[model samples]
Target: MNQDTPMLPSIEPATLEWREGQPVSARFGDVYFSRENGLEESRYVFLAHNRLPERFANLKAGDTFVVAETGFGTGLNFLATWQAFRDQAPSGARLHFVSVERYPLTSDDLRQALSLWPELESLADELCEQYPPLVVGNHRLVLASGDVRLTLYFGDALEALGELTFEADAWFLDGFAPACNPGLWNTSIIEQIRQHSRPGASLATFTAAGYIRRALADAGFAVQRVPGFGPKRDMIRGDLPPDGQNTGDGNGSILVVGAGIAGSLLARNLADRGRTVIVADRGEAPGTGASGNAQGALYAKLGVQFNDQTRLSLAALLHAQRYYPANTPRVWHGTGLLMMAGSEHERLRQQKFLQQNEYPDRILTPVSAEQARSLTGVPCPHGGLWFPGSGWLEPYRLCTTLLDHPNIRTEFGFRATRLLPCNNRWCLSGEGRQDLIADAVVIAAGHETRKLMPVLGEFRMKAIRGQVTSLPSGALTATPKAVVAGTRYLNPPMNGLAVTGATFDLHDSDPQERLSSHQENIAGLESMIPGLLSCDDLASSVSGRVSFRCTTHDYQPVVGALVNGDGRVLDGAWLFTGLGSKGLMWAPLLAEHLADCLTGQPAALPRSLARRVDPKRCLAEPVDTGVPVG
Candidate 1:
């Protein structure tokens, strides 16, 4: 796949309508059917027949079940199921509903249709708020305060089902009647459904046609005839026997190498879920990777129009700012951020975006160069967007705080040299053959992950060495109230020292601290803040540290499941690397996403943005030209 090509499935168009005073919905074009019965028809034919209330009774804390559906017109069946689950299940249990819909109704149409159920209004509102963009492929939405996850495969049911892998606890065969939609009821679709069913998985549908029963039986379901809900005479209900059980859940133990932000955050999330996780790194303590910087700024840049990268950055910035802790040992001064108008075109573009959208004016402001100087306590050639909520974070301190949770065990000075899969478990080996095993593993060792997984050797992840120079506060009479950005960035003085950086070296990988890069960084800062101080005086108080940042071809971080061996196996392993210079702004949210996928919890970020960070795409495609390289 080309880097520019979007990894989304195609969607087909279809129409839906509700039968007035009737409980049925009629889909037009490829499938046409009516809920000839009332809403009770859905309850009896879909819910009771599948024995859902009883299944809910069996759920325990942290338990999750998957439900697969053939059709999702109007989402009535989903809404009903969500309401039922919310009323019946235990507090901590989660439900994942995987539904396929070739054509999805507009938000307005959904609101109108759902208006028939006044009781479901609140849930309907949540759904509308998180509705996916009118695009194809899998779109995930979080509902009911993150307990109910909905993954909508908006495309051909058969093709989309083929792309999904799930162990469903129940199946809602709510597609149009067999006669109206034979393509959906065919044996091929039934077989695909059978592939995802777990042992004793029950299924319920409103149809009792002969071919439907025969096809389902042939596809592995033990079909039974049951009295239909409402006026319908009969319906089909049954269960699929268990295939084979593989221990994909890493409940026993796991080894995570790299104690930086990625590995430490992963450890915290896993430990919170009661999993025993050990975080290891070569350094004597955690956060010694690229995360050891004194301070890093958080901000998102937008291009002229909404492109893929721009959209992704916007979504990430929103999600991260909402979730990252507001109070920590590390200083979090909302010093805001200043993105100078380096060019006239950029200034015009920023102005246009501000005028078009009702974005938080408190977070962003347009000002003149003199006004920018007043706000930031520095001289600027041009004014640009000012983000008030933006600030700097002590990366090392935050990483250590995330590891402070009791469930997370840390092991320093243990560098992982090899990762091998043995007996359906991953074993990390190094240092005199000391090994630790786990049902699942994550490779977050920055650029070193490619070395461990040879299949990813061809990926475009590069290690760009960088150095940040620290100068005495005497260089500036007044500390900046905000971080200033243009060609370089300068943070407000902290503890009598102001940090400014960083010099980028694309050709270097060695971690050796270089004086030349430090000098260059000081020069870069002077260029951004002219008349601040001379290089000679700044160099006298300057100190620096070097680190390498992992970067992907597209500048987005790799944060999902790993694809290995010619796509034959989606190795239980995952990744959370390639954060590059945006670690402070992107890591917290990306780590939350990886945690959601692991715990089967609802993702906080948009599905489109999530795909941009999926680790599998890195192995499948070449470098993306969408990112701007400095």
Candidate 2:
């Protein structure tokens, strides 16, 4: 969809009230949990009825059990299930809890509501800390040091489960009373649950309504009535028999041709999900390519209009902000970011962005010049966009940490020169290195990927050369506490140096840094923040880096599976390049999407957003620089 398409509305925070120290939903006129021992009620209804404890213990090594719920009113059920899974499941097993909520509780309200149960304090604390911004989409949280995963869909329950891609082993048929919220128990919702349920999947609910039982029974579940919790007498339970449908793809060995952000993250994600991942890169270490930026920005650069690219970037930036602290803490912080309006054109663009979209200020806000200066600890020429949840991080360190996983085998110096079919697997080999065969392969070698997979030429991605000038921290009079960007970016100091400039040159593949590029960067910096640096006279000790970045004509990354011109698979090959320059902010979410597409799990992005990064769009769409490229 283009800019003319209406933007997806933001989710409103749940209006809650307290009745006798128990939280009640103001909208539905229902209590979030039973006033009589909510935790016990949760365990008796969802955990016990679904037989989760026994099922958790029965899971094989490396097995991931999925539990889906129609509503996540207070997270009481999820916490109880998590506690049980941890106590009873084997160490090697993982648990994925998927739940939907149209109106999510505010973090403060959630903390206060959950404070009623001290037994679930620890798990509740983590859940509250990792809770997503109340946005109208899915948010994936990797908690318990990656052993437990949660995907919270903040939209209509039916639409969520319809787009969701996963096989649930157990279902928590939850929501308010059928009379209060019939949408959650409608035929469409039942059909989606049945469609996602595994053959032997079991379901339990606190209600035993006849229509609900009949709907589930018609959808292939063997319905039963069970004893309920609290004042309820009878509850519903069911087991779905298989429909003989083949779920595409299996957990298998995968070969990733690049150890850059996209490839490294994708490899590690697949590995964490129980796939054996072999990472092959030509460099002696991770991020030696374009991913080797010393300090990179982690903010979404939205455009003047809410187009597909801007929408995806916003979603990805939010996802990555959550991912870093969840998966790898202390690597980065939300010290925040400032995008200066250095030019009149940019000033108008930033103004238009604010006017066109009604995004929450918690994500981004238009700041005055004084506010920008106050936020960045520098002089600001013009009012710009301020992102409170954005910052910078070392890409090299990120790649290294991601590749240092047991499930991911890193071949640092393996330059994958060829990709062809061998036996039933894809063979990835280079000039002298040993051939590596895997059930699937991901080509993420930036521009060089086109050489390995000739069919990628149809995708029309380009290799652009970029340069970033670095100045020692000691060289600057005062450094911005946060990352600042205009025509060029000035990141907070890393390795005793602050970085700026990145001359975006098309078709130039020079590996050597040029003085002209450094001058251009310094000039841009001078124009953005006049007295921030004395860089014009400080070139004697200046150092910079040059790298070739893969970018599409439209500047969006190409992700997911690649099909040939005739709409056939290209021998199990996947493409994940064209990240342009926002790899740090874009990599995490896009990598998660590729992993989902590969493993047949729930999607990280909606279909329309995902299509913007599809190979077909990157190939077929004409370049329209009508708006600023985010």
Candidate 3:
């Protein structure tokens, strides 16, 4: 939970030796798998013992089967299980495999290790292509067109597993031998494992150590020692006793207000989980609100040190990068991001931040002025941070694509006037059409959320107006290869055009294009890059758009279940608003969280972070100054 605390040294990549044409780990002094037949050994020890084939086959149309693993050593077990699910499971069922790894192998090393087994080559290649950078966080990978999802936790299992908030239907206890790695089989860890397992969860482990058996038994699992594969005499298999948790009925209709990034994503995620979704917006189409920006940077803006906000931003950034497709031609440009130190004070802050943290270079690399210029082709006056995984996205395109789901029904040119309850369900009524009824309702209407639901008035959502200017690509003598930000941002050329200047005005809701704002943008560019552009060159030809962004007083998004005036959470109403400026980076993961809350599944974010963004947070801790609504 202490995200700011320094991470311990990463796991050293396993050194291997060829023994009888089998891979042997030099560190653990154990074979990666049985020398006689590794693939068959994995299938028998994990799949057969867990009864995954039957479990997967029995899954209903909208059900999700989650499998958690202790170690993801060559990902051999994951690939075999994926293949089994592909062969045996229904098409509508989804497989969510969460694996924790201390030291991850390089892509080249993984390729070589997986090359030993040709049977899993296809799955191995897919995993290799999407393998995340060596960063210490969750990297969610959606494969096979969203049928299979893999969340790889790149850190020590002991620390990483505690951060995860998901209930596993099956567990793959596939770490090293208990005799060699006793830390992994400790009592506390076994208890944590039990905490994250759903009722009647099945578990499989190759080790049959008596200590581990006792640990599993004490942790509430009805464990049993069973026949092992190959030469091994016995393995451990068990099932956790049922724990009372509300598993929602699959057939529920929901209505989502707004069709921007937040609502579109929430609608799609719900639809993916087999819920009928209705997305209502006042615009002619989706992304006509704040998400209609031409080009927005997709990276976390961190402070000098990590805090709750920065930690949440980093998680959201990582999740968006992994969940959304970034190379969909005109949709997203994975050109990386550069944040410049425009002033001496900011330069000192950057230096102090880099000196205090030992982050992986892939996550954030402190670059010198020369390095920044060389990498981005922008002459940043001072050194800054470079985020390799950041990029620029066309929000309108992204939202439209997300709303293209089969289960999503869009109602454009319509706005809801009131939220009324009918027969325990919700009704969304407007002026033109008949009332729309649903089992649940989600309010994602940006700044108009608090206005629509008076109970949320305590959250005090503020509307911040922002304007972005765009110029012809040829206007600049040189273009940055990536998005460069200091006082303002300059995205790389898209469709022979480049965008700049998003001036933040807290109390201004004027949507008209302003020449003064364009001049300010040009000044901003001059400060970051001395000779990029001049006011005279772009003052006459620049085009810009303005939109209002919404945020809460504490700056955390108002997500999760809605709370009534009496402080009880409304059963079928949710709020997913107040994302402010971080919509592109934050929307996807928050959408996942909302979906979890709706489906009675485990949360995707930490509970601490979740509580911070809860809709009732403002009510729980009343602020001295009330929320402002204009």
Looking at model 2, residue 233 earns an lDDT score of: 96
lDDT of 1 by residue, 487-512 (tens): 77888888877778887789897687
Please list the C-alpha lDDT of all candidates, in the order they appear: 0.71, 0.83, 0.81
What TM-score would every model get versus the actual structure? 0.65, 0.93, 0.91
Better structure of 1 and 3 per lDDT: 3
**Candidate 2: tens digits of C-alpha lDDT, residues 1-630:** 466433443567788988888889899999888888889998988898889999899877677788999899889899999999999999868888999998888888999988998988999999998887776776878788768888888889988887667889899988899999887888888888988888888999989999999999999999999888879999998997766765434678998999998998898888887789999999999999998988888877776666666768877888898888677665775679998888999888877766666676678788899898889877778878888888888888889998888898988888677788888789987868889989999999998877887453365778888899998787676778988888888987877889997899987978998888888888778778887785457654589999998888777888877666544567578999988888888888898888878877767777667777876655443244232323
| Candidates sorted on TM-score, descending | 2, 3, 1
Candidate 1 Cα RMSD (Å): 7.9
Q: State in Å the error of residue 162, model 2.
A: 2.5
At residue 281, candidate 2 shows an lDDT of 92
Return the top candidate by lDDT: 2
How displaced is residue 368 in candidate 1, in Å? 3.9
- Whose TM-score is greatest here? 2
